[model samples]
Target: MDNDRAFMLSHTFLLKSVKPFGEGLWQPGASGAPWRSDAAEPTADDCVCSIAIFTEEPGTIDLDGTSVSLSKGSAIQLRSGGRFSVQSGSGSATGRLAGWLVEFFVFRFGDSRPIAGGFPLLPYHQEIAVHPFAALCSVVDRITRTADGYDDPTALRKQAALLELLALLMENQQRSHMLDNAAAAVKRAISYVRDHYTEPLTVEQLASIAGVGRWQFSELFRRLTGKRPLDYINTIRLNRAKELLLLTDDPLREIAQSVGFRDEYYFNRKFSRMFGCAPKSFARSGKTAASRQPLLPAAKQARVRSSLTGEPSRLVVCGGILGDVLSLGVKPLGAELAVMGRQVVYRDKLAGILDVGIGGDADTIAALQPDLVLLEKEGVAASHFQSAAAPVVSFRRTEDVTVRLRAIAALLGAEREADEWIARHEDAASSMWNRLRSRIGTGETATVLVQIGVQLFVMGNRGLAATLYHPRGFSSSEGAAKLAEGSERFREITAEQLPGYDGDRLFLLFSGDERSKREARQLTETSAWQSLHAFRSGNIHMTEAKWNYDDSLTRGQLLPVLPHILSSRI
Candidate 1:
């Protein structure tokens, strides 16, 4: 379809300006520029509606506080009395924005007005593929090309075209609804929440997991579960808390953070609401969680017992626990070392360490014949290692990671060193925050972005983003919060969500993986990548994956280097 011909009659929807069913100057506007729309305020007396179609490049439409991306061939419903603007995908001259726009006003004809409980329409600002594209083109062409545009024949023709378009939209919306239902996208999101409920969760992150919009996901979840997403997450946490209360004797505060609730008072209230009493009262009642109970009685129950008199006299580290042990100044006698993969970050620091290959090569472990073995409780370390040459200990999974590190330190006779290191880390973070706080101010936000393969992840509280969220550190950007505070440490977001992560500064982590690096390079070339606030302000910096995450040694090393990265932004 020719954009010029379609747009010439585009003014006053249904081709040509006419207030056929209403008493207002219905106007149609067309835009094909590669730029952002200025913020427009809606008039109180006039209620307007329009449909915008992407013709060239996709851009984001900010309606009120919500941001949604519109892709090519996709259209969105625009209503009056709401905050609205169309933002270019990026600032580059190439890949400029071009789209079809139609706007109309309804001032009421007599007592006529739009019907109430109107078809349970979709939430505002959401984009959808318009089906029957050929039919819509036909209708628009007929209405606009007519020589007698304002005659009775023209009016009748316009009304019919309007109805046809409405029908097509209704049909298209249903198709989208059915797809969402069949996918059970909300159910998948619920599972992600249940698993990672311990981390701070946001609706955006959950919706992304489910491959749906945040608004639609919330609505469908409420319809299916009869509760809000946050309410459901709380229920899951409470149930886990109940099981812990019955099975273990961990403290209430510890249990609270363990289950994802950061506030004890809030946890107590929700617990009472769900189980009819406080966490303590629930635990004291000796009530077992009915659902998590084992189906069959056990023939034998085994416990992980320690045979060591003290920390292993000679330590052999295995698996991903390399960073934790290395942080305490204890050199592992033998560890899984490699040039790529998990050990890549620690390569330069761990030069001469005996390469044990991957965690537990029974032959290698036996060959090292170390006095003690420190390993994770899940894999080889958790397995029966009686046949190995050394005694093994597994780190307990808990809310406080430092607890395990401290235990290891005690065994290695580096208690003072560990304490000193902790003090140094804390002091350095505090000093840096204090020095930068005056310039950045409180609530100034920053976001850390990570790309692996073709996927882009917003790094959450588990990495450098977490360190920056110190007491005096910078606040997380709105979009960044969805990932940083959510269940997953990293979340994949659509290009439209880039604005949500927009802030004063952005940290991009490159792991030196060819696929990810290649994709990352391609991303920077797009208009969407060029248009970012950080990119425009020159506040985006390239760094390694290790510095952006929550690993202690990596973060400690990063504390000093980060100031230099932010020097320009500050």
Candidate 2:
């Protein structure tokens, strides 16, 4: 129940390499060490966490006696005790091969174990290897330089950078795996549930689509995804029901049958449980509010028209990561807001956009003829904002429903609407907060970590309404530390170099395909995971990527159910 432990478990890290080695070379041994195929495999005593980026030279690798040839842009891993040997050419050519080797070692102290079939790490392949690798190198160089310049090598500043790198790597790997396995039969099952939730779907039917027996499919799905097929199916149906209730004027019974519920009474019961309100009440209240609101005033409508036709006013957004702006929701918001307001705009770069050559492009902004611009205060320089003619406003990102809505409202000139939205949102958020606060009651609070990729950034508890409910109080480990100094990119880390973050609660955000799922499963099953309080109490939660990244009305549809998922663990 230690709050510190809970906070640490919820943080994550990301690491990317800036200068990846060129293609066509054998995997180099440790730093300054040459390849030795005949060398004895390292034993458990010699095992350490290591991550390497190497280019294969159109040669074959002997994987535990099975020969598998690797292609360029392939990422390969070397486990603590697992041994693999690679030869340079198809037949004869040996000597010194061409290519570069960048190795990252992650060292975790105290009890640590590998995940995913003992091959805890995998290669991330991009169609063009140059960009992703280059991004990684940039992140690594920045982190290393920052760490070196610190007056104290083991200073809190260095730890923060290292944590962020870890979260970033974990998220990158998870996301890549998710994309790769999006077409798998298991994923097909998920898609089917999403598309046909309105229709009755039995376990047998879902299992057929997944190409497995009902029992086997159920077990496998739960093991890989942390939720049973039936639970996931019901969750989807309930989500759709909520959407229809909010967006449409359909009657309660009709909406109930539309989402596969057999009876209106049963639907109302379930809806109230999920959303803390009955369907009829929710719909009626929402309708009343909409009916009461007045349309845009004549003067305001004229101003909007004038702004569109005359000199466009520039709008600038600041203080968010690169990924925040590049997300599907944010991107469309930018375009729609721009068209509506008629102005030049600037936005922060989050995730991979910085490396995609989109940051600070003057020509692109010029073509849009925007008078205003938005940029992340932390990610962009003062010189970058000097050219903008419009006002630049800075805002912070947080989980607090009120803060986020207010920020968006202020930006879009819809503060009154934002206030209404906040009130409704607060009604739900506040109730949950009260329930959580009563349970915590000056007792030790649980620490939680949220994994991104290799970077281990902590979520801010101060701005999060949920934490306020806990009487014992909660805080982020990174709250007092200085922001990690680096370019906006993924950083690299060896498994051995990862820090020990045993906490009371663990929330994982996996970003890759089936491989990443397997890795996460392996991590969960390990002895290290079992030893943690969160693991023992079953307080771990895996959130959907769409829910985590998408910031549209769709997100609102999912928000009410979050407290149920998190609080159920307690």
Score candidate 2 by TM-score against the native: 0.33
Single out the weakest 10-residue window by summed lDDT for candidate 2.
479-488
Top lDDT prediction, candidate number: 1
lDDT of 2: 0.43
Q: What lDDT tens digits, residue by residue, belong to model 1 across residues 352-462? A: 577766555667767766666766534343344555655465653321234445555655556676666765665577556644442354566788888766667786666
Model 1, CA-based lDDT = 0.60
Error of 2 at 425 (Å): 1.6
| Cα lDDT tens digits for candidate 2, 439-516 | 232333333333444434333332121332232233222311111112112223333322343344555544435655
319 in model 1: Cα distance from truth in Å? 3.5
* C-alpha lDDT values of all predictions: 0.60, 0.43
Worst 10 residues of 1 by lDDT: 299-308
Superposed by TM-score, candidate 1 places the C-alpha of residue 179 at a distance from the truth, in angstroms, of: 64
